[model samples]
Every structure is written in structure tokens, then in C-alpha cells.
Target: MKITVRQEKAIDFEDITLLNDIAFGQEHEGLLVERLRKKTPFVKALSRVAVFENSIVGHILFYPVKIVNELTEYESLALAPMSVIPELQNMEIGSQLVKDGLETAKNLGFKSVIVLGHKDFYPRFGFSPAVNWKIKAPFEVPDEVFMAIELLPGGLMAVSGTVLYPIEFNM
Candidate 1:
């Protein structure tokens, strides 16, 4: 199926929330999305939806998070709660949303992005274990699943610290 990816609009909220709930088979992720939408660091340009046959089939959101090392806190994006309609898993919609979101993040001057996600899935997008950059997840997690990508050349090479995710993520 042909898919088009574009920035999410206000009209897409209900569909996006429904897409997340249906994709995850739960309400938690959808609620998280709504909460994130209301907070600072919500990058509307980086939030995207995948459309097929005039309907939203997938959605992705990127928001700001901090990587604190001693006195300095570096800004970065976090990829979380990305979802596609369960019936269409592996149909390339999720991949397209990820690729587009990453591009948007880079263009917007983000130095890096972090994701606590599938070890097998995120690598294809150039993510590697955060440990490689001396970065760690805020909470304990398998190193392989806590990943980071440098948007700027060498952006993450010198960075080392714990990520600080927004509180809404814990909801």
C-alpha cells in the first residue's frame, strides 16, 4: 500500500489517539501522547502521521529530553510510543514515520535522539546502544534496547550521562 507521511495537524488528534490505542491495544500510550502534546518540548513539526487511503494508519512523535553530564545538560530528542495499526505491522508505515521524524529532528538542529525501544528495530535507523557514547537510560534497562543516534557528525561522541525524560512519559 502507498503511504504518505506528513506533520500532524490539530484535526488529526482524535485519529492519532485512536491509532495509538488500536496499535498498542491499550490506552496508556494514547494517554501519554495527549499529555505530551500539552507540555513544553512538544515539537509539532516532528510529530507525524502516516496516511493511507485518506486515513491515518500510523503515528510518530519526537519530543525534547535532556542528557545531563555534571553541570551541563545537553538537549536531544526522544522517540517514543510510535505506533501503526496492528493489522498493518511491518507494512513499512512505521519505518517511514521513523525516517521522516528523524529527518525533521535533524533539520531542526537537534544534536541527537534517544529511544528505549526494540533492539532489533531501531538499529536500521542508525541507532546503537547508548553505552557506546557513555549515555545511559534514566532507569535500568537492557543496554541494547536503550539506544542513541547522533544527528550531527560526532554529536554524541563526547557526551556521557543519564537521560532525563519528561515526567509525562512515566504516566
Candidate 2:
């Protein structure tokens, strides 16, 4: 089967919703995707979908984020709620979507990307524990699961703080 990863278009919204719903077997993630789309920080160009045989099989989204400390807030991106059709879970569709999304984000001039994801899975993509950089999540989650990757050299070296996820993520 041939696969292509690309930025999601306006017409792919419903299909993406379905893919997220089926992949997670619930409405929470799917709803978050929908709500996030309407938020101010939503980056249309960074949202991506994996297509195979003319069907969308996977989805990923990166939202504009701020790493804020007592001194200041640093701009960044956050990866959230990535999903793939369950039947194709191990086929790398999600990976391709992530790789494509991150590359697009970097090209768009994002400095760093944060993710609250599987420790093992995200590490393969060059993500390291955000704690190492002195960053913390807004909520209490395992340190190992909160990860970040610098798109530009020294991106995270100078910036370390709490990630402020969009209100939609908290809602």
C-alpha cells in the first residue's frame, strides 16, 4: 500500500474527526481536535494527515505554545492527540505524519516542540525529557512522559519553563 503524508485541508475535517474517534475509541480526543481547531493558537499549516488509497488513515496536530518562567515566555509548539486507524497502528502511518508535521513546523520557523506522549515512542523522534531542560508541565504528569525537541540548535538551551497548553487542551 502506498502512503502519502501532507498538510490537512479544510475538506478533511470530518474524516479526521472520524479517524481520531475510531483510533481512540472515545469522543474526548476527537472533541479536543475539534475545539482546538477553533482556538487562536491553532496552526493550520502544522496539522497533517496520512492518506492511503485516497483515504485519510492518520492525523497529527501541533499547537503554538509558550514556555513561561518568572522572567519571560518563549515561543514553541506542542504535539497533541496524534492518532492512526487501529488496523494500521504498526505500519508507521503515525510516524510519517509526525515526521512530516515536525519538518513543516521547523520550516515555518518554530523553535521547539513539546509533547505529552509515550516515553519510548517519542524518544525515537529525538525528543528528550523536558525536565532535563528545567521545563515543567502545567499539570502534574510523569516527568518521563513530558518531552521536548529543539528544532533549531540551542533552541531549548536558553529557554526552560512551564508549558502553557491552549485552553482547549485543558477543557
Against the unseen true structure, what C-alpha lDDT does each candidate score? Answer: 0.91, 0.90
Stretch of 10 with least lDDT, candidate 2: 162-171
Cα lDDT of candidate 2 equals: 0.90
- Please provide, for model 1 over 20-112, each residue's C-alpha lDDT reduced to its tens digit, 9 standing for 90 to 100: 999888898989999999988788998899999999999999989999988688888899889999889888888999999988899999989
Assess candidate 1 and give its TM-score to the true structure: 0.97
Per-residue lDDT of model 2, residues 23-133, tens digit only: 999887888989999888788888899899999999999999899999999999999889999999998888888888889999999989999999999999899999989
How accurate locally is residue 75 in candidate 1, as Cα lDDT from 0 to 100? Answer: 86
State the lDDT at 20 in candidate 2: 88
**Cα lDDT for residue 131, candidate 2:** 95
Off by over 4 Å in 1: none
Give TM-scores for every candidate, taking all chains together and pairing residue i with residue i.
0.97, 0.97
RMSD of each: 0.8, 0.9
